[model samples]
Target: MKYSREELEEAKRQIDSTLHKLRETIKTFEAKEEKARYKSQITLAKRRVKAFEIANYFIEEAMEK
Candidate 1:
């Protein structure tokens, strides 16, 4: 997918914010169910962050060409 620099920056910011929230939530919870939910959220957030990073790299490469 094609992404502009502005969009990539926005995505990066949003992803970072989401990851932060997920990590904090994970840290706050101690119950099994709550911890499971937070763990899943954290895993999902990490995957999203990585995906966006790859997409940003593609955008960078496209910018160079």
Candidate 2:
């Protein structure tokens, strides 16, 4: 399947937003002694990183097209 340039741009924006939120959550967790929340935040951060990679890939593909 092929994505339009606009679609790719939107995906990148969404990924960026998600990553920013995850980072903020991690910072908040760091200020507390909630082990479960901290662990969940780490997981969320990892997922955001993966989403970023996917967004980057789509953006590159769009550029090539």
Candidate 3:
């Protein structure tokens, strides 16, 4: 399905907001006294951040097209 430009813009905004929150979460995880406790969660969040970044890139490319 083809999305309207407005919809694509909104999607990008949402992804940006999510990425910001995820980064904050990673920071908070790292700041813990026992960093090892959050290691798995941190790793998962980092992977998610990367995946979202790729998704956002694709969205931008689609918008360009």
Q: Which residue runs of candidate 2 sit more than 4 Å off their true CA positions?
A: 34-37
Which regions of candidate 3 deviate over 4 angstroms?
A: none
TM-score of each: 0.50, 0.64, 0.95
lDDT, candidate 1, at 12: 60
Tens digit per residue, CA lDDT, model 2, 3-64: 77788778778877877877777677777877675787677776877777777786877767
Sort order, lDDT high to low: 3, 2, 1
Give the whole-model CA lDDT for all candidates, comma-separated.
Answer: 0.64, 0.75, 0.96
Clashes of 3: 0
Compute the lDDT for candidate 1.
Answer: 0.64
What candidate 1 gets wrong by more than 4 Å, as runs, is 31-65
Candidate 1, residues 1-65, lDDT tens digits: the string is 77776776677667567656755654555445556656766666567667756766765666666
Candidate 2 CA-lDDT value: 0.75
Among these predictions, the greatest TM-score belongs to 3
TM-score of candidate 3 against the unseen true structure:
0.95
**The CA-based lDDT of model 3 is what?**
0.96
